[model samples]
Each structure stands twice: as C-alpha cells, then as structure tokens.
Target: MLRCNLICIGKLKEDYWRKACEEYEKRLHSFCRFTITELPESRLPDNPGKAQIQAALEAEADRILNLTANTFAAALCVEGEPVSSERMADLIRTLSLHGTSEISFVIGSSFGLSDRVKEYASIRLSMSAMTFPHQLARVMLCEQIYRAFQIINHGKYHK
Candidate 1:
C-alpha cells in the first residue's frame, strides 16, 4: 500500500472539521497508509509586515522540509497547476511504479508557503483558484486523495 503523509500547518480546532478529517482518514485506509502531521503556525501581530510574513513562512518551510525529506512532495498553493481527479490518480499510480510509494502533501498556514518549499516540491497542486481556510483545505485535500484512490481502484465511491 502507498503511504501518504499530510504535513500541514495548524490544527483542526472545530469538531466538524475534525470529524470530517477523521471520516476521510478512515475511508482512506483501504487505499493508503495515511498520516497527518500538524505543525504549529507562527504567531503574528494584528498587522504583520511583509517581512514578518516572509519570516514566518520560511520558518514553517523549514519544518515542512524536515518532515517531507525523501518523499515525493506535493506543495499545495493557489498558484499551483490544477489537476483533474483522473489525472491525480494517474500521477499517484505513476509515482508508485517509480518506487515512490511514500507521498507527502505540504500545506502552508495563512501566511502561505515560502518559495523555497514550493521549489522543492515535485508537483505543486492547487485545489482551486479561490482561497480556502487552511483547516477546510486539509479536509478537501483528504477527500480528493480518497477520491483519487477510489478512481484508481475502479471503486464505486467515485463517479
């Protein structure tokens, strides 16, 4: 089975979000060994400057890099290329065949990811053009991953 690690900033504080993530994690068991590692977001003032945000993003990137080392990393960003569900499934399948069974998805905090992190990614994936709350984004990514696996397996869950 493939091993998927979600290295995301910030924790799920809401019950609904937690439940939603747990549900997808459970569903994904049949497809991959899924794990979520939440890193603490950097604290910032009410009106943080551009330099402050950059510093925070760089700090977060350092943590993400350590966690995702040696894995096929996919950074989630608004500027990333959009991919269809079938395309995502094909990418995963191709990666697996290349001996990259461990895939890591990197999600940044409100400040977003640093350029270095994005540069390190094998692929940069955009869930959509619009912005979403990081917590909701995490759940959305999980669902898409599950859907991708289902599509790959030719399961009825995907239609």
Candidate 2:
C-alpha cells in the first residue's frame, strides 16, 4: 500500500477536529497506510516580531524535515499551488508509478512554514487561497486525501 503521512506542527485540541481526522483515517485504511505525526508547535509571545516568528518556524522546520527525510515531502502553505481533487489523485498515482511509494504532507504552525521546509518540499500544495485555522486545515487535508484515494480507486464515495 502507498504510505501517506500527514506531518503537522500542532495538535487538534478540539474534539470535533479529532473525530473528523479519525473518520478520514479509517476511510483511508483500505486505500493506503495513512498516518499522522503531530509535532509540538513552538510557543510565541502575544506580539512576536518577524525575527521571533522566523526563529520558531525554523525550529519547527527542523523537526518536520527529520520526519519527512525519506519521503517526497509536500509542504502545505498559502503560497503553494492550489490543486484539485483530480490532480491530487493523479499526482499520487504518478508518484507511485515512478517508485515513490511514500509521500509526506507537512502543515506548519500559525506563522506558517519556514523557507527551509518549503524549499525541501517536492511540491508545495494549497487547499485554497483563503486562510484557515491550522486545526481546521488539518481536517480538510485529511478529507482531501480520502477524496483523492477515492478518485484513485474509482470508489463511489467521491461525488
């Protein structure tokens, strides 16, 4: 099975978000070995400056890079290219065809990813041009991965 990893720099503290992620994980089991790696988010002050945020992002980036070292990392950021469900499905299929069985999707903290993380990514992906809470974004990414697999397997779950 293809290994799909969702590596994020924060926890889904809310019950609803956790449930949503669980649902997607259960759904993805048959399609792939879907796993989530939640790393700790760096703490920042109430009015942190650019340097502070950059420092935190860089610190978080170290952990993210270590986790995704062996996989084809895809950093999820606002500046990334927005991909549709069909394109996402195709990307996975094509990657597997080319012997890339593992793909890691990284979602950064509130300040977003560092330059190092983005630069390390094989592809930078964006769900939308609009902003979303990192927790909600995690759920959306989970759902999209499920949808992508549904498309890949010609499953009826996707409409």
Candidate 3:
C-alpha cells in the first residue's frame, strides 16, 4: 500500500472542513493509507511584520522537516508546478513501482512555506497561483489524492 502523508500547519477547526476532509479520507482508503499530521502555527499579532512572518514560517518548517525525516517530501507552493490528476497518478504509480514507501505533502500556514521547507522538498506542487485558506487547501488536496487513485485504477470517478 502507498503511504501518503499530509503535513499541514494548524488544525482544521471548521465543521464543514472536517466533514469534507473525512469524506475524502474515507474514499482515499481504496487508493492509499493516508496520514494527516498537524503542526502548530505561530500565534502572531494582527498586521505582523515581514520578519515575524518569516520566523513563524521557519518554525513551522522545522516541525515539518523533523516529522518527515524518512519520507519523500512535496512542498505546496504557489510558485510550484501544477500537475494534472492523470500526471499525479502516473507519478504515484512510478513511485510505487520504484519502491517509494512513503510520501509527504507539506502545506504551510497563512504566510506560506519557508525557503528552507521549499529546499527540503523533492517536488514543489502547486494547486494554483491563486491564494486559498490552508483549511480549504487540505480538503482540496485530499479530494485530488482520491481522484488520482481513480485515474490510476481507471475508475468511473475520473470520467
């Protein structure tokens, strides 16, 4: 089974987000063993300075790096390459065949991923250049992951 991890900063507190995530998670079981890990987000005052944001992101990056020590890392960033569901499925298939036991997708907090975190990534994947709340990003990622499985298996969900 493919071991896929979603490492994100902060908790999903909204009921709708939680429910959405749960639905995709249940569907993901047929594709991969999914692990969702939450890292603490720094509590900064409103209108934080650039330095403050950078520090917070650095702290979050450290947590992510520590947790994903033995897994292939994919950093979610606006500047990264955006791949199609079929392409992502093909990538997953290749990784499975090549003996990649685990894969981690890192989603940063409000200010986005730190430079160090981006450097740590084996691949930088972008859902889009447009900004979205981290909570929505998680739900979107989960759905796409499940969709990727459908594409790989030639399931009707992909049609």
Candidate 4:
C-alpha cells in the first residue's frame, strides 16, 4: 500500500478535531497506508518579532524536511497553489504512477512554514483563500485525502 503521511507541527488538542480526523483515517483504510506524524512546534513569545517567528519556523522546517526528505512533499500554506478535489486526486495518481510510494503533506504552526520548507515541496497547496486555524486544517486535510481516494476508485464518497 502507498504510505501517506501528514507531517504537522502540533497535535490536535480537542476531542472533536481528533474524532473528525479519526473518521477520515478509518475511511482511508481501503485506499492506502496512512499515518500522521506530529512534530514539536517551536516556541514563540507572546509578542514575537518577525525575526523570532522566522527563526522558529526555520527550526521547525528543519525537522519537517528531515522526515520528508525521501517522500513527495506538499506544503500547505495560504500562498500555495489552489487546487480542486479532482486536481488533488490527479496529483496522487500521477505521483504513484511515476514511482512515488510515499507522499508527505506538511502543515506548519501558527506562523506557517518557512521559505525553506515551501521551496522544498514538490507542490505547495492552499486549502482556501481564507485562513483557518492550523488544528482545523488538519481535519480538513484528512477528509480531503479520503475524498481523493474515493474519487480515484469511483467509490461514491466525493460527490
């Protein structure tokens, strides 16, 4: 089975978020081997300056890069490419067809990903034009992945 990873810098603290992710994960079983790798989010001050946030993002980016070095990396950020569900499905299918067995999607903390991480990604993905809490983004991503699989297999869950 293809190994799909959601490498994010933080954990889901709320029961509702966790439960929602769990649901999608459960649905994804028949499609691919899925896993969520939570990396420690860097500490930032209450009133962090630009430099401080950049430093923390860089630190987190290092860890993200290390884990995703051997996989197809996708960075989720506000400025990333806006793609539809069909496009996402196509991306997965195309990657799999071209010898990519592992695909990693990276979600940064509050300040978002560093330039290094974004530059490293094979594709940068934007969930939407509007911003969302990182925690909620996680759940949304999980569902989208499951939906992508359904679309790929004609499983009647996407539409």
Query: Measured by TM-score, how close is model 3 to the native structure?
Result: 0.96
Which pairs of residues collide in candidate 4? Answer: none
Candidate 3 pairs with clashing backbones: none
- Of 3 and 4, the candidate ranking higher by lDDT: 4
Task: Please give, for residues 56-93, the per-residue lDDT of candidate 3 as tens digits.
Answer: 98888889999888888989998889998888888888
- Global lDDT scores for all candidate models: 0.92, 0.94, 0.90, 0.92
Error of 1 at 119 (Å): 0.6
Task: Write down the lDDT that model 4 would get.
Answer: 0.92
Question: What RMSD does each model have against the real structure?
Answer: 0.8, 0.7, 1.0, 0.8
TM-score, predicted candidate 2 vs. hidden true structure: 0.98
Better of 3 and 4 by TM-score: 4
Off by over 4 Å in 1: none
**Backbone clashes counted, model 4:** 0
Best by lDDT: 2
**Which digits, one per residue and each the tens of the lDDT, describe model 4 over residues 1-159?**
888999999888999999998888888878899988899988888999999999999999899999999899999999999999999999999898889999999999989999999999999999999889988999999988988898889987777
**Candidate 4's error at 150, in angstroms?**
0.1
Candidate 1: residue 46 lDDT (0-100) = 96
> Positional deviation of 51 in candidate 1, in angstroms?
0.9
Worst 10 residues of 1 by lDDT: 127-136
